[model samples]
Target: MLSSRHLIFMEVARLLSFTKASQTLFISQSAISKHIKSLEYFYKTGLFERHGNHISLTKTGQALYDKLLEASQLQESLHQEIQQLNETFRPPTKLAIGASTTISLYVLPSVLSAYLRQYPNLQINVLNRNSNNIQNALLAHEIDVGIVEGLTQVNTLTYTPFMTDDVLAVCSGKSPLRGRALVVADLPTIPVALRENGSGTLAVIDDELDKRGIPVASLPVLIRLGGTEALKNFVLADTCLAFLPKRAILKELAAGELVEVPIQDLTLQRTFYFIQRKGTESNQLVNTFIQFTKRHYSNRE
Candidate 1:
């Protein structure tokens, strides 16, 4: 890892404000000033020209900043590659991944099990969040790859389609709506269970319904929950209906515990995406995992 001071300097250069960098780095302004002074002393040149509260990088400082950014990326990449090599002799190749709730809960676990059967030395750490959170994690460089169901494209991240998932309106077996295809306008009459605001599933549901002139807010939401399992459990035990990914309710649907209520003249669907930082298209680990996921899904079809 680069020294804290160097990382701090990089933030300062990127943001062009020591105060802003200090807040981002979670350090006091005095500490940021001390680090900058130390760097300036070592280089025997002023890195920033200060006037009032604002600061700008000097000519020499600009060159140093550019070179620092290049060197840091190279160093990090080399470290990652070297670690991958080192881990081959040692067991359990470490991989960090992030995914939206539906993929993490329903889709990826089987793929992971199959992958581990093929490569027993692999070890993975998974972070589960909403699609928007997963995208933010990718941009923050906190995870190597993300699987998301984001309705909108983020320019800073690259998205590749991994699979298509349909969102189904589901209810418990005893509900009057069971097996009865519903008109779009009937959605507002039923008591509904919903995923929370940041949910990718919720976003798609709202967007599709909005296009049909029935806003999600117009629905009679009986409860709001964070995870699919919780919402599913509620639907299983109550008459309230939920819109969930079809993949998520396969077991329940098969067991006849839940019913897929088809909507009249409308379909709800979204793509599950493999996401990475925009410039990481060629990273070995990311490529390996994405290819594995795609091939795994294709084999099922």
Candidate 2:
């Protein structure tokens, strides 16, 4: 059983409202106040500062809240594991995953099918969003694990390399530049499409171009779309080129629907990473899935 005082304090800290915490925990407002008061008396310091209608945690309160938040998460994870172990007969193991657009669309679907075959008892939920949003989801504890193509690191998150993605410039099969190699100087002449800002593809593109004495904004950008599929569609309908993951355009390349445009003296690459909140690697479900993904990609290499 969880300590009532600790649980009540955590709820109040999370919600920043005694009234809301009481509603959430299905207790009386007076009871909530009583528990908080007792905790403050023991700690000998104020945990929350109350205004007319709102409340906020003090520095000491924030530190205690962080610790208690981790403890709550551990408690939930522990209960899940124990239940799984107790009912080996038909254990329900759930794994919720958050993924960026590139990994969710081009990479993980195939991997998940095989994973499910091996652990049919496991239930998996996937949330596909932009790389930045995926990181936010992990930080918010909305998902168990995340896979993203973005290389930006959050200090409180861990990024483990899952696979390498080759990003290539491509155009429709009918484009004049089809199957042609171009010099860096020629990049300025061609009309180009780019992913939306803050995208992993755009990030890598920016990095590579910056190293070559060019800025992405200096390029002849025809359009900027929010996702790979939109950019691919726009490119196929017009005489524009885009940098995309090879995996994303493999079928198109193989079928001759799109052609890779070679850039001399430059190769753009980004790694897809497994992401999790710091200290979450010790979680059983997270550890299992991370190890599985790493082994799968390592064997392919």
Candidate 3:
């Protein structure tokens, strides 16, 4: 457990706003200020430098903040170790996961079903969001684990390669474009539906397109949607083409409700990763689920 003053300082330092920290801690801004003043008096130095409404940590404050983060990690590690050594301790009863849209809607349902059967008493919660939001949730400690597309350079988190996914260009079976493969040059003429700006699907599509000198902005976009299912439904009901994960549309493709529109030189593929805070990799429940998921997918291949 952290001291009250240290806890207040940590929240203020992380947010860099006394008002925001107060709201996060469910306290008043004046209370936050009082704690910070006391910390400064104890340390015999200012922790933050204020320029108008903006505040930044002093060098000593940064050092203390870093140490506190390390201490938090250490405390968690010690708790896990104690649990391992105690024979009478019950296993963790809850798990929270955050995943991007595609993984949440398509890939995880069967895996989670099997996992729950194995651990009948464990409760699971899933948060479905775009890739960018999933990463933010992990950093904010809102989820115990996150699985998302692509890797980022956040040093406080650890990413492990989980699987590869392919994105396909597909259109409605009844559309005029069905069975007609296209060249990259033809894309400018056909209206396309895309995922929203922060989506991993959009990011992967744009990256592959850029490598071929075709910027996504150069294409004619008919609409932008927020999730994999919404894009798929739009493509099903409308004539616009879309790029979607292969795992997401296996049934639609199999039923001939959707047809793949192969582009002459374009193939969009990306890796999905398991994300966790750097210090929590040894967490038994998370690791168990990860290994089980790997085995589940492996057997399908």
Candidate 4:
């Protein structure tokens, strides 16, 4: 078993902030410092380097933290195996997951429900933000795992493909573009509604459009909305067109409330990824949740 001092050191290293680690571990900042000091004394090396207000892990600290993480994983696995052998009641565990707007709203609700049913003692918290914010939260250790639209190319993060999603051009059925085949040239002529900046949907759409030699900035956007449902409602109430994930509009598309306006040779496909900090692959709870989520979607197919 890892010592309490080691656990405290890991938390502080992960967050790189004594105050944050203290709040997380429910201990006073002074107490956190004392434990870290004790660990450093035992190892006969400085574990953290301080620059006035900021703190960062030293080389020895990083190495120790990595080893402790491996040990923690082994401990958790052993505990799980023992529990399985005895069929005993397990203590409640919390898993915090951060996801982009689309996945949070359209994708994860059913999966989370099923997961809770299978593991009733587990508590799950879902943080719904745009892709950029989710990536930031993961780096800051604010969440255990993250699901986002595209790969955030930070070397410290690991991205696992969650699923592929298609963003479709759709407008209200009353719009004149209903049944009209649009070409690349016609995109700039139409009034478009778009997701706000820093949005994963917007970023993907912009990248695809740029590849086609027609930048999204060249299009005549009528309004920028924050949420998917907000933009969908705007499209329904107005005569403008918008790009939305197919999963978000299935009911409306089936009911004829919206019509898909297929542009000639324009397909917007983006892959959603499950992201976590490097070396967290050994986390059993996160691995189990990811597999369960993938299975939930695969079973439907």
State the local distance difference test value for candidate 3: 0.88
So what's the TM-score on candidate 4?
0.74
**Could you tell which candidate, 1 or 4, scores higher by lDDT?**
4
Q: Considering TM-score, which of the candidate structures 2 and 3 is the better prediction for this target?
A: 3
lDDT of 4: 0.89
* Most accurate candidate by lDDT: 4
- Per-residue lDDT of 10-41 in model 2, one digit per residue for the tens? 87886689888888679999999888889889
lDDT of 3 at 194: 98
Instruction: Supply the TM-score for candidate 2.
Output: 0.74
lDDT (tens digit, per residue) of candidate 1 on 1-301: 5677887887887778877888867899899989989999999999999889778899988988878866765664675588687854432355669999988987789889998887676778798998888888777656779999865788888888888888999999999888788899888899999999878899989998999999999999999999888899999999878998888899999999999988888788988889887877867766888898889979977
Any runs in candidate 4 off by more than 4 Å, and if so which?
A: 1-89
The per-prediction tally of clashing pairs is 0, 0, 0, 0
What are the TM-scores, per candidate, against the unseen true structure?
0.72, 0.74, 0.75, 0.74
Q: With candidate 2 superimposed using the best TM-score fit, by how many Å does residue 127's alpha carbon deviate from the native?
A: 1.7
Residue 32 lDDT in model 1?
90
What is candidate 3's lDDT per residue for 133-250, written digit by digit as tens?
9999889766879999994548999998899999999999998999898999888889999999878889998888888888999999999999999899999999888999998999
Candidate 1: lDDT of 121? 67
Q: Write the per-residue lDDT of candidate 4 for residues 44-138, one digit (tens) a residue.
A: 99999999999988999989988886686677677666766887848557688999988999889989999999999998879898888899998
Candidates 1 and 3 compared: the better one by lDDT is 3
- For all candidates in order, the CA lDDT equals 0.84, 0.83, 0.88, 0.89
